[model samples]
Target: MELSPTERTRLRRLREQGRSDRAALFAVLGAGFVCHLGVVLDGAPMVVPTVYGFDDDFLYFHGSVASRSLAGGQTVCVTVTHVDGLVLARSVFEHGVNYRSAMVYGLPRALDGDDKLAGLRVLSEHAAPGQWDYARRPSRKELAATSIFALSLDEASVKIAEGPPGDGDGPDAALGLWAGVVPIESVRRPPEPDPALPGDITAPAHITALAT
Candidate 1:
């Protein structure tokens, strides 16, 4: 789908190279495990880190209904980002970061009953890949104890800034400052099973590949 003119212009870097398609957007969302949920509580803005998942059109977040950040039916903004590297150049002003990020703006729709249970499953799977299927399903009472919200991706933007710094070979290079890229990565360690669990327990495939 084509991005609105406003959206295209809003993202400074993306206006030139960022993608504005459903496929690109979904790929970013799938790779992300954490999202910053921004909500307006009593006219104040609050951003909370939370787990989230998404299909093609809507993104989902699950939390306690009693959460102060999500109380009532307040509007929210969600953002997910990956810091790829630190770009160091001869000039401090040219120093920057390489990253991929997405911003979502919408009102959260509360999910209850079966929908809430399914939303939780989606969240779990997104955070841990195949672990959702390997784990036991939630009981009816357990489902009732949790709350979930679905936000449409009808209005959002994806922004990405990548590649080497522009000052690497410019006049600023004569300054003799060390200039290079410092890559950042996220990795997961082996699972630490509970001590009370049976000794025969083994790590699942999802738990094994989380270090990426």
Candidate 2:
């Protein structure tokens, strides 16, 4: 299904880079576990970096129960972005970055009971695929101290910018200067075991697999 753009999600600038495909939105969100959440707290605007997870219908994030930023039932904007490369052009004005990003806007709902636990599971697995089962589950006391928020995925905007610089045919091309893409990639390194762990215990297969 294609993303249905709402008034706030409509792309007004560089519309060519805007994507309406739901798959594009999913790809951007799946590539990164962190997101910037924008909200108002105590009548002031705040943006906080937090871990996020999403399914086909909703996006979930959590914070301490005392965190004012995580208080639900208010409008919020969550954004996830991945930078692919630098687009070097002959002219500085034409230079840009290749990237994929998604912005989700909605009034989040505070989750509780079974819904809260399920949201936490989705958050855990999204960051570390199999660790939700590999590690111990949250205790009742821990759950009581946490607050989870769920935002609908029905309102979102996705944009992807890629390929070479855009000044190849422009007057800048005659400048006789170098112009190309400098690629950037996020690579996972070998897992570092806890210093206090037992010598006989090794990194789990699922964790070690990330390095490959």
Candidate 3:
């Protein structure tokens, strides 16, 4: 699906790097676990780091029922970014990061009853696949204590910067300094079992598959 751009999606710098594909937006979000949620609490701007999950058109998030960002019918901006590499330029001024980022704009509404539970399940499964089914489900009181919010993915923008360093042909190239791209990647480590678990209990296949 093609992404419909609003004013926010129009890139001023390196406009060519801006993406117009909805699939790219999903790719950036699915590759990362954390997002920065921006909101105005009271009279000041605040950014909170949290986990998020998304389906086809909606992103899900939750926190303690008392969180001000989730209170009322508040409009917010949510951003997810993943650093793919470091662009090492001969000149410090030309250095940059190879990355993918997305910004979503919407008013988040609270989900209750079955919707809340279902939203929570989406969030949990996205962050840690198979755990929702393997672990104990939340109780009535536990669900009551949590506050779930849903934001539409319809009004989102994506920007991706890839490839090697941009200064290879510039004046800085003559300096003889080593300048290229340093690729950055995320790898899963072997699962560390909890100390409190029974000796016979082992890591699930879903968990171990991350390393393979």
Candidate 4:
């Protein structure tokens, strides 16, 4: 499951933090729902924050038909990142963030017909499990109004940072300043009912589970 990195995706800054396992990449990706997509349009670089989903091989996301990045057969970079903690070091220069991140590089392909619908299902399932089947399906008109793109996950890079501060053995240790990790976590709060929702329509069990 080791990831075979392409020349463009190779680790340079923090080689020690780079992960070669493909499963590590998938794990980082699967734990998050939103990703920033980077592409170029009309000689200008652009990055769009969008919701995403993935299978074993491809990452899927959607945007408006007018999106400049949605053009067929364009190379794009997608990054998914989760901040785990703040790394406090004895010295200000050594302070950093503990995180898990992945960057994927590939040419995006447009999806249509049955493939498009299936991709949309994957996206919905990723954002909220069981919602695809629970919510009303998208009509043909809705599908026509959206643009879905898929990119292979085969070319990607993964990095992870954890534990306490990294300067324990360095000169900063002699400085005797307090240094440790401030852990961060994503906590799901109770679901807020929509004001217009019918009283008879209750939240589903999957949603209840998510809100815990």
Clashes of each: 0, 0, 0, 0
State the displacement of the C-alpha of residue 6, model 3, in Å, after optimal TM-score superposition. Answer: 1.1
Give lDDT tens digits, candidate 3, residues 1-212. 98877776667788888888888888998997788888887778888888888899899986553266557667789899999999988888888999999999988888899999999999998888998999999999999888878889988988888987788888878898998899999888999999999999999998887773
Model 4, range 155-195, lDDT digits (tens) per residue? 99999988888899998799878999999989888888999
User: TM-scores of all models?
Assistant: 0.87, 0.96, 0.95, 0.95
Off by over 4 Å in 2: 65-72
Ranking by TM-score: 2, 4, 3, 1
Q: Residue 5, candidate 2: how far off, in angstroms?
A: 1.3
Candidate 2 local lDDT, 63-123, one digit each (tens): 5532665563578898999999999999888899999999999988888999999999999
Q: Cα miss at 1, model 3 (Å)?
A: 1.0
**Model 2 CA lDDT for position 77:** 92
lDDT of 1 by residue, 1-212 (tens): 75443442366643765667766678779877788887776677777788888877789986563256665766677898999899987788889998888888777888887778777878887888787788888887777677788898877777777888888668987887788889997767777888898999877767878864
Q: After superposition, how far is residue 152 of candidate 2 from its true place, in Å?
A: 0.4
Reference-based lDDT, residue 183, model 2? 100
After aligning candidate 2 to the native by TM-score, how far in Å is the CA of 159 from where it should be? 0.4
Q: Model 2: what TM-score?
A: 0.96
- Candidate 4: which pairs clash? none
Residue 39 Cα positional deviation in candidate 4, in Å, after optimal superposition: 0.7
lDDT of model 4, residue 205: 92
